[model samples]
Target: MNQHPAARLTWYAVLLVLALVFSFPLYWMAVNSLQPLFTGMTWFPVRPTLENFRLAFTLQPYWTFFRNSCILALISVGIPIFTSFFSAFAFARLKAKLKGVLFMVILSTMMIPPTVTQIPQLVLFKQYGLLGTYWPWIIGGLGGSPFIIFLYRQFFMNVPKELDEAARIDGCSTFAIIWRIYMPISIPVVATAAIMSFNTSWGGDYLAPFMFLQERQYPLSTQLMQVGYILPSSPNVDLFQVKQAALLIFVLPILIVFLFGQRFLISGIMTGAIKS
Candidate 1:
């Protein structure tokens, strides 16, 4: 049943090429980050240096941005996960009127463009005096995404109903049953959701933070725009290199989280997909 040697070698060659092609952007980021002060767009650096990275921190309050991102990410991820778990448990197990219709409506919202409600949400938050503060971001975290809820719902459905019965026999509440039994066995899905939430709430998110937070409260992502501090006194500096350095720094934490949780993430998605 094994393929011929030449065919297998050709397959591997194709895979290698695809991998390199997909990785080119990240490779470019690394190359640019380590590039010397004056290099422009390049496939390879003639004299790679650490100065770009050195300046990435000096040009901005990179650590403060990092700290704010961590806080926002944690708050955003935590609230959604907590809410989604209970909501999913209810949908998957507990009987309710119009449950399927409600679930469908939730899923349907994903088809609508988020921008449609952006102004309305902005006006509502402003009325509450949350404009130009982190409160709006924190408040927005309360509404769990439908996709995450669906993932947990699928995973919850796969758990044995007998567990719930046994928990009930022991006088445990439905919430207790979920926390004690289902969640313990759902580590993969939990990790997958956590990683997804963290990544979504982290870098590359300009809209929500930009609307709610001032420049002083900006995360590393927004701070990247004010990259003018890299060489304020010098007009002839290659800003492309400095911006690339900021981009790499902004991406590193999520990259680390993904690498660490990749196994769990894949397994969880696969399990949820199959179960649903």
Candidate 2:
């Protein structure tokens, strides 16, 4: 059937507006980061300079924070992807009598407001002496995240049973099946989980590192809050430029990753939404 020209034009117009709405902030940030310190707020920076970017690296131990953020984000994203994949595969393919009940119990955790458990989690981490280190964040990611597992399980279940049966007939073990066949076909869901996990860890401000670490060990999110909000009392403070630069440093990595992975991210999200 032929498409309606007016409807297509309307859809394109709507998308263009939506794109501008989403992109405006990023555009402003990029523009602002290049502006002179005392230029004030303007639509366009009259004198663009690399001074903000330069000051960002020079003023704070920004590189250290960047490295720490990368480590934290990697562990937080990677652990969930690995653990959730196997757990999801089990839920999708295994035939244990307790499977349904156990899955329900796992899913139930998602219903509980995360805030309700924050204090308890902090207390537990402190008691175990895991605070002030990466352990807290790492442990959180190591668990089979309920939402990710649910998404993966749905995708895995959609794969033909014949694939598993054929692999088993050839004497392939569960591990072999997962590694050799199922995983190969599940790239989109994997990408989805990775993107979600990475974004969550990269942007998360309230938990994980917050309760578990001190100022010295704070990740980019916490550090950004510190540097951005805390203005110097002294007149000598290059407060405006320094903070702008710091914020730019903190945001650049995530922005770069998103730009590079956007296509895969979109594909993954769409494909993962398809129920088996």
Candidate 3:
């Protein structure tokens, strides 16, 4: 009906406004990144320049930061993919004693704030002399992510058990049933886990690395925090512009990844929701 079209238009207008509102910080960051630091910034830059980008690289060892983050994210994601998948498969397909109790304990952990365990984990790492190395990040990833395990378990539970039975009859082992039968079809959920895990690992908060890594090994997120208080040692440059440029550069990888992964994210969440 004509009325339906008008109503839909009104909803679209409302949603667009909400979207713009939420996106304002990113818009501001982009605007600031292009503005000259000495211009004192406006809603939009009167004179846009790539000078800030040039300064951003000169001001810090940005290449090192990018590399470190990539290493951390890849390791973090890789460990979870295989470990969480098998853990989920076990929880979903295998019969075991006290399964419900063990699972409840794991789920209970999500209720406890991460801050509460941060100190204990830090102390434990320090005791093992892992404080200043990538071991902490690697070890933490290998420890198993309960959230991802839960996601996998949920999605795995949604699959038909008949698949397992059929695979077994065809001389497949437990691992084969998972790798051959379940995994091939679990693309959506797996993608969701990988994307979400990478995002969590790549979050702008550099505090985790800040606490563990030495100054030279600090990531861009940590370096950017220090940038605010200490402008580049050079006296002749614009400070604000460099900070904005760094913000833009620092966020680009995650932004690019999310853009490419968004379709998978949507489909994966939809597929997983069929069970949960």
Candidate 1, lDDT over the whole model: 0.82
Better of 2 and 3 by TM-score: 3
TM-score per prediction, in order, is 0.92, 0.91, 0.93
Q: Order of candidates by TM-score, top first?
A: 3, 1, 2
The runs of at least 3 residues in candidate 2 whose Cα sits more than 4 Å from the true structure, single-residue gaps closed, are: 229-238
Query: What tens-digit string does per-residue lDDT give for candidate 3 at 34-127?
Result: 9876777668877889988997887677788878778778887888787888888888889999998998998888899766877898899999
Higher-ranked by TM-score: 1 or 3? 3
Candidate 1, position 48, lDDT? 83
Give the TM-score (vs. native) of candidate 2.
0.91
Residues 121-150 of candidate 2 have per-residue lDDT tens digits of 889988999888888767887787999999
Write candidate 1's Cα lDDT for 1-276 as tens digits: 399999999999999999999889999988877777666778887788778777777777778888878878888788888788888888999999999999999899889876788889889988888887767756666777788899999998887788889889999987788778988888999899999988888965667776777777777766676434446787565467777887887888988999999999999999898852
- lDDT (Cα atoms) of all candidates against the true structure: 0.82, 0.79, 0.80
Q: Deviation in angstroms for 125 in model 1?
A: 0.9
Candidate 1 vs candidate 2, lDDT winner: 1
Evaluate residue 98 in candidate 2 and report its C-alpha lDDT on the 0 to 100 scale. 93
In model 3, which regions exceed 4 Å deviation? 1-3, 228-238
Residue 242 in candidate 1, Cα distance off native in Å: 1.9
